[model samples]
Target: MSFNVALSGLNAAQKDLDVTSNNIANVNTTGFKESRAEFVDVYAASLLSSSKTKVGDGVLTAEVAQQFSQGSIKFTNNSLDLAITGNGFFATVPELNSLETSYTRAGQFKLNQDNFIVNSQGGHLLGFPVNADGTSASVSLSTAEPIRIPTASGAPQKSSEVDIRMNLPAGDSFISSAPGNFDPEDPLTFNHSTSVTIFDSLGDSHIMTYYFIKDDPSVNPNEWMLFASVDGKPIDLEDPAGGGTNPVGGNISGPLSTGGGLTGARLVFDSSGDFQSQIPTAANGGIITSDFSNHLPNGADTSQTIQIDFNLDPLGPNPNEPTQFASNFEVTSLQQDGLAVGRLTGIDIGTDGLVRATYSNGTSEPLSRIAMVNFANEQGLKQVGNTAWKESITSGEALAGEGGSGTFGTINSSALEQSNVNLTSELIDLISAQRNFQANSRALEVDNQLNQTILQIR
Candidate 1:
């Protein structure tokens, strides 16, 4: 009986030392939990009708339960490196078709070739996917997709119409009466060259030139001012100061750009008696139009629409005019509107476990509010690898809750919780385990010696 008791002690001591060794070995491992060995002393039981016929043997090993106290989290420079605070584990979705859900505390992640956020094993991180409005509820952990941070918004639009819209000051130069009778056949012309940006059918952009010369009379001595419109609105047209007032010569004048000179047509009385020109000629650039309001059947203003579409196909028989694009742009209002363009810089976890991302545009957003779980019997949890545990029949269902609620602790970013293993306590326990094993071995030796003496006496 004494030998049996010593044998039990030795077994229990050996188990205790093993558990301690494991704890010490993984002291630096992330999310490693220390475990405690539990033991139960053997009891004698009666086997006869009075229940006193037999006695139980020695001690028994009850269990080696793990301590689930929160481990400290250290900050890593990688934005994808994540750490969970409190009791919750991250849900992961494997990339392959094999349906398997894995939970982990290791937040290390990276962007896959397709820009998917995935772990080292290519398991995608799970989270409620956000919509264009940045809100969602139809998603779950099992169906979470990779959340990609966008670099830019939609494509830049082409200039369908080049609109030069401005009120050219009605200057004192206008004789008010004499300037109104300006004729195109005679010659007092203001020649100017203006640059235009045009876009091709493939959305490629190009530069085009428009030269204007006002045909006024030399006898009038009044300089003729030519107005230029790119798409629909009037655009700035000025030649290199030395290019003089004529950007285009006589043979290349008017909307047609044909070898022939401009044909004079009757300036008509419109339905509103407005002085509307009868000829489809585009003086300067094209008839000033706003929002596609201008009309000319055979004008340089092609069907291209806007200035962003200004490029023409020189390959065509007549590159000057098949379908002209409109170019209308207003830059005054751009400065007036308070707009912001920012990029995501970094993300930080709050003490309350909220992940907040900062942007280069001086803006920030809450990525998600972290969730944690608690259990009725933590000791009953079945330990899985990687500092994670799963609920078993012994451990009750996980009680999911937010941080700062119940016994759940709040998380701190940039700070990790240190291990609960106290070197001093471990050292003391190690010494006790060693001594206990030695004492049990000595007792066994005594039992052997006593048996030998009895045999010798016999």
Candidate 2:
């Protein structure tokens, strides 16, 4: 009986040592939770025996319980590395086709060869699908999928419309009215010039230059002649070369007579510097139309018409409307509706767990949202190695939710959760376990000596 009690004590001490050693060993492991050894005293008893002086047999190992307390967060350089600030675990999958889901606190993630975010063990980080508005498609854990980042955003889009808002110097010198018309080759003909890059159907870029020439002040004080060109080629206006719709037969002079030369509209400003009226051979609400289909490059669509809008409504936003200020000609704002194939530039995670991807085209798109899961009893989860756990009967079904919602924790991107193990406490526990083991061994030695003495007496 004594030997059995001593042996049990020895086993309990060894179990305590094992638990403490494990805690110390994983002190630096990311998201590692420390465990504790629980024990209870064993006593000999009968079915209905009432004994006030009952003696205990020995210590028995009850359970090895894990401590799931929050660990300190450390920020890292990688944006994919994540850390949970409160409660909940990151849901993951071991493979693409795996049906079972694993929960983990470790968030040391990186992009795999295929650009899927995964852990070092190749386990994919699961996330909920997101809509275009950055909302999660579903909150169920079963619906979570591996996160994959798209390298490129579809195809290129051709420029169809352009919006321009600028100030034309109202005090510039006037040019010769009749003989000195707007010319792209002669700088003296135009007072100010600005250019904007426009894309074609094939993503080829072409510079569209706008030239403004102040008219003779004596004849038209509030009038300014405009000239449009593309890559130095004149853009033909709907109005003929002469004043109105009539096409003057005589050949024009200077650059206006060139092959690509095109007549432009005239801008008139009120005395208060506000826009008054603009006259062109053909225009719709102050918007000039150009057919780039004739100048399409590299098999691009030649029938594409580009709308140039000088939305200079006096009632429009002050910054978006053109002003005839006595200042240098400046383009306040120039916007276009075309972009080339976009390359992935950066990725970010929001407090709501929405993963956003930014492209070189100055656009952002929602990729996927990180999925968080909570259990009724975290201690009931069965450890599956690699700082992860598997669902068990004791652990109730995983409650799936987005980060920062309900009892779930907010995800800190570009960070990692350190191990919960306390090295100082583990070292103290180690020493205590060693003393307990020594005491148990001393008891066993005494029992052996007593047996030897009894045999000698016999």
Candidate 3:
């Protein structure tokens, strides 16, 4: 019995040492959780005729339980590197991968060749796919598996509203004939032609500049004629070139916040490539009209935004919509050319886990959402090596939500999750386990010597 007890002590100590060694070995492993091997007492019953108190037993090896504490996050410059700040596992639905379904806190991720978000091993991060409009990619996660994101945006887009600034010379006044036409008594009426160019889906730019020419008050004052021009030709703005009709006929739409409208619009073009505009020319000799506007209005100038919307009823084989990106996403921008512009300038996930982008036009969009996943029974998880873990039946179903929602933490971009194992703690455990194992071996050797002596004496 004593020998058995000593052997059990040895076994337990060995196991404890093994556990500690593992912790120390994985000290730098991302998403790795430290562990400790438990020990239990083994006992034999000394039974008398009527026994109440039981004799104590020796020791036995027990299960190696894991410590599921959060690891410190290390910030890396890689946008693909993810970290779990709080409690939550990154939702991954692997395809053609080893684990059919699993969960993990190891946020070491990267962009695959296909632009699909994936683990270093090419296992993809499963999520709802985003459309061209950047909306919810998934309506149902059941039958429809998480989709892979492609590398490229579907197609480049054309801007809807362009800023046209033609100096009024501070002394010019106009009077027109129509109801919404320029009234000689009103300072709100337009006098010059304002044109803008819009690019198509194929990146072919069309010069659809508007002509804000007020029917030459000296000529037809009753009909504040509205004409549209394309590539320097006097186009019947009411009739766009190639096919579609023009949006601005007489008066441009009013601003949303305040009821302010711009009228006396004309589109003129000289298809002969001999287009000259004295009124619409910029101080730099460049056209004062642009397809996209960058606003930088200092002070309380009440920066304005003109929302010009157009549909994609193209002339040729093209299927797209007329859209524009403005202000750092969600916020609106002014009409000025350049100032404090933060248009989506290459969207990258922020340290806080927010997905935003930047544009040359000084606008951005809310792209993807990042969230960490935590496990109720992290010990119940199956290790997939490479600092990754998979959910097991014991780890319970995962809870999915956005960062900063529920018990999740905010995603800090360009950061990484460091390993949680402490080297010092592991080393201590290893020494303790090693000492116990050594003591147990000594005890066994002493017992063997005593048995030999007793046998010789007998």
- Choose the strongest candidate by lDDT: 2
Global lDDT of model 1: 0.49
lDDT of each: 0.49, 0.81, 0.51
Candidate 1 vs 2: which has more lDDT: 2
- Give a tens-digit lDDT track for model 2, residues 282-373: 34565454566567657988777666676756463355667788888888888888876677889998877899998876778898999999
Off by over 4 Å in 2: 177-180, 236-255, 259-261, 280-286, 314-317
Judge candidate 3 at residue 368 and give its lDDT: 56
Greater-TM-score candidate between 1 and 2: 2
lDDT of 3 by residue, 1-458 (tens): 66777887788887888888888888887777788787788656555533455544577666677777778878887767777677766666666343365566777887666656778665666544345455545433332233233334333453434443222221233443332443323325444445455444333444554434333434432222333334443222112221222233333322212333332223222222121222222333322222222221222222222222222222322122211111111112113222232233364765434455555544556555553456677677777776667767897755555566667666656677777888877777778888888999999998898889989994
RMSD of 3: 13.5
What lDDT does candidate 3 reach at residue 346?
Answer: 60
For model 2, the local distance difference test gives: 0.81
**How many backbone overlaps does candidate 2 show?**
2
